[model samples]
Target: MTVTWAGANARRLARQHLHPDAAATASPFAAPGDAVAAMLGAHAQVLSAAELSVGLRGDGLTRTDVRTALWTDRTLVKTFGPRGTVHLLPAADLPLWTGALSAVPTGPNPFPGNARMTPDQVEEVVAAVGDALTGAELTIDELSDEVVARTGPWAGDLVMPGFQAMWPRWRQVLHLAGHRGALAYAPNRGRKATYTNPGCTPLPGTGALPALIGRYLYAYGPATPAHFARWLAAPKRWAAEQFAAQAASGAIEEVAFGEAGPAWVVAGDTDVPDAPLRGVRLLPYFDAFAIASAPRERLFPGAAWERALGGGQAGNFPVLLVDGVVAGVWHQRRSGRRIAVTVEPLKPLSGARLRDLEEQVERVAAIMEGTAELTVGPVTVGPHA
Candidate 1:
């Protein structure tokens, strides 16, 4: 069988790459792992608002299996650190994948225009926040207050200028702490900050970071270092570090990605290629398989990126990937009973493909809390360049 380049695209590869079990490559999440491994690998967490919203309206159904997956194998996690947003990533892949994300360096010289806190100040804030969050969960405000009290009123002012600048580091600290020790979001805080320690047992921590990159490679790989960097908001060097780590572990191999630059092949044994989009999938707005790869052009080529994600910021569109490559954009018309979907195509979707896409939409509507007729509107075709 000859591998063809014409059909080679991220979305196409992704549908071919995803696991049916949804269990990640990490061990605890894999079958037959100890409770400690499960806790250490992928401690399940409720999806953040964006995470829930992204997947809710599309390809996935939030069901009992979703919950069980959360427990037995690490299935859900707070996928965050890029553009300062949260996503729900698979649990087993959480640690190392997140590590790549959190590895952003905290430095003063870097990122001028209101530079970040001084090294001493950064160390102090991290230590103070870690201490405050160690025993139990605390809201950011609550956590900040504790840190301020420990230091003084001036402490908040001292950190005020650095707040947003340092948030990634701060978020990383909390997440890593939650992973290793026990500092999680407080229940008092809303779901965003509502974190708790899963107190059964913990794994002998494998360290949070390089692990994240490893997961991204295995799950969303054949991707470039830049792709990882872009996806995680990480420095190129950090991306390189992650790739290096995975390479050391024999977790990755090199592969061709056409014009998308270098891509690493996931080295772990995987089930043979099984393409599901052959079935038409109404993906949740940000189903990671679509959004996780970062650059829109590299992932969904053609003039689609701007037309889809480029109104305000780049790549902010809910895509419609028909038979792989982003064939168009889609949205939900939430009425009362049924959810209406309007698909705007970049190229005319043929009758058969259109039927396939509709079948995917029907599944999406069924995944909702209640049943309703799913009507895929007329395929509005055009080269919306």
Candidate 2:
């Protein structure tokens, strides 16, 4: 059956718990960890953004609640997972993420020329990281020292030039350690972040890829293999093979998504609700809903794309979602006891939407634990530019 974009949007919004009325219902999530588990995980490259991502989906959850889940309760783990980015995932789900990520063939080393380490050397570094981080949390510098000590001085050699500085070749293996379930971020010590082994064992079997793909579709379908591949940062051929296998097994079924063409949803998740998406939301940077949706042009239509996404990049700034579509971009800055929130709409909003925007601003203020001042105007994009 062909699902129109409108139907898809409504389903997506409801499934994500972003529809205003849906969000108002008794929250499906009982805690911050529940929200993370439901969404697969929240992008946590920026801790505040990740916290807000959970807060938006959870009822009456605060930033402290998310921190407690990550540090105090240890119910959630922060690690490099999909797309090799840091994410806050349910601790119990680490096995699935680790096994799935490890199944992907490692891509080329980012270091240039002779600086690149052989595959063996890369494995050596990964092993060293596991050893260094085991049983104790260590800052990056401290961990690097241990890596060098374990793998010789060459492990400390700088490579991979960046806009500001060069990164050590050994640092590349950090994500590998995470993918192997040998590394995760520990609670911050003073102001410095540390890493430690999470002590999670992979589930006994070889169904990791299929399990991970199933979870993805449950949260972010109906989508194509290409979308899954892009989200996982895995090769398209590998994704297609896995997708085809699942389709053959009746684990997933194909459906047409209007102009988006053929897509797959979990075999039993084809029912799209006819809910109207209302109200405005101030979704923070790397918000899962905005980042995971496919057929980018449809999710982010017209000037909404350029205005909110800048030069086609996702997650650079917070977004303003009006009726389940990317209607504008927004930024929030906190100082002392106040937060200044500025919004730039691609088009004029209705009076009711403007009120809904104010309510969202209030919600943002509450999340920050400060009073908010709303300013409606164009936003200056780029990270703190």
Candidate 3:
């Protein structure tokens, strides 16, 4: 239907506010410095590779889409891997996107679990990895070995050191690297690329922070600072303040989140309840539209989500979106070259919803080159007995 700029702002924060230039899509790596700058803002960082990847798709484009359409080198922008991350933005966003997205987090850490090391040991590991990756790029395998050799006793050997405390700190170190411009990605990460150490630059401080937050809300809002905080994993107080500052500007608008005060948003960026909505689709696991916004249960039931996604690692599982609403959950897997996709429903889908999910799945298949099988089925439903 006719989704108003306002309603669009409210419901589709992940999609509405993010705007990577058409030029980057035209030629993603051809001196995409400007496009990147526009996309990422001043700090030039992204919070998580997966998040960036999903945001790109929500933009109606995928990482590879930017490549095929942009017809530029993939080595530079989206595929630039590691921090164990990927960013779907152009070369320019390296600055601001990092500034906005990189500095915080939500949920538990996604880093591989390794709890043997103390903070200093973790620092040593980071140092070892950074040193190996300083001039030349190295794979996680290579980096892991170096870390083991340097620190000995191998606390996180070959493992990503996924403990909760370490995860946040590691995220910061990577963010610091991105700010330094030392954060770029390696050649490939298990076939996908890794984030590089594009070098370092000083952060923009508090002033630039809110602007960065506003940009995020512009692209993804009508939510809480808690949501923003969770998304960035920044301290709660700092995140709330950032949202407030941005809200003061007419560019932001706050709406109610149940009994709470209105959540901050880019005012006209998402659903305002007064407007209609656009078409719907099945979103990927870790899709920005699904996880990026908070009161996450806003779209789905909490208990069901925990069950569907295996607790803290809610990153797994597919998401269904009908108009602006989250419809349900689904998933895809690959056996050899065969891709099997399945939809496990939380609620029964209407005929129209089923048709919509099919279309979205095809879109996903197209992204993966349609080389594998895809399927859909009910999650768990039993008698009232």
Candidate 4:
């Protein structure tokens, strides 16, 4: 059956708690891990933004609460997730994530031979990293020393070009180590980040992709293999093949997605919301909501397509969501105990929507442990870190 974009996005918003009723009535995610899982994963390239990404979706969660779940409770593991980006994923889902991510087809090494490690050398470094991180967290430099000692000088050869210097060849496999269940991020030491092994066993990769596909469809369904491919940075052909196989097994079913054409949803997840989701939200940079939603034309419609996006890429700037779709861009600057939130709306908003925007600003400020001053004007700042 064909589903309208409004119907599809409504359900997607409800699943991710991006709607007003869902965000207000849904039981607050029992823990930060639960929130991370619901969003698939929270992008953590900018840790503060990641915290807000998770915090806002759940009821009354502050940045400190999110940090506690990460550092103290250990319920969330900071690791490489979809698209090989830093993300906060649920610790309980590590086995599934590791199994699934490790099976993803990666392109050939882009680095020069001097900077790339052979398959066997990559394995050796992954094993060494696992050994070094077991039961102890080590900063990057410390881990470098440990890896070199355990592997060899070849492992530490500074051949890969970095910001201003050469990087060790072994660093290329850092994310691979995470996918192999051998590494995860630990609490930072001052300004230096650390890594540790979560000590969890990874399930076999054999049947993980189909299961991951189901999870993806549940959260962002009425989607296509192309959408899945874009979300994971996996090859589109591979994604299509997987979808075909899954469909053959009756694991997923096709549906007409209005003008977007046919899409897939988990076999039993064909129900759509009765009405479009309504709400105002302030989404942080790289928020999973903005990153994973597909048929980008719809999620970022009209002016948002050009303004909120960066050369067609999503998540470069913070987003202002009205009715589960990107309506504007936002920027936050903190000064002492106050936060200045500036929103640049692409379209004119109603007086009631403006009030809703103000309330959202207050909510964002509360989550950040500060007061917010909202300004609905041109946001001068550009893409954030």
* Most accurate candidate by TM-score: 4
How many residue pairs clash in all the candidates, one count each? 15, 0, 77, 0
Q: For candidate 2, write residues 269-307 as lDDT tens digits.
A: 887766666678888998888888887788788887776
Reference-based lDDT, each prediction: 0.47, 0.83, 0.49, 0.89
lDDT of 1 by residue, 173-279 (tens): 34434433233333334344544443312332346554555556554555678777766555777668767777778877665555555567667423234434342
Cα lDDT of candidate 4 equals 0.89
Identify the leading candidate in terms of lDDT.
4
TM-scores of the models, in the given order?
0.65, 0.95, 0.64, 0.97
* lDDT, residue 197, model 3: 52
Candidate 3: count the clashes: 77
Worst 10 residues of 1 by lDDT: 27-36
lDDT of 4 at 192: 94
Candidate 3 lDDT by residue in tens digits, 178-211: 4345555554556643544545342555454666
**Which of candidates 1 and 2 is the stronger one according to lDDT?**
2
Model 4 lDDT tens row, 168-219 = 8889999999998899999889989999999978787768788899999999
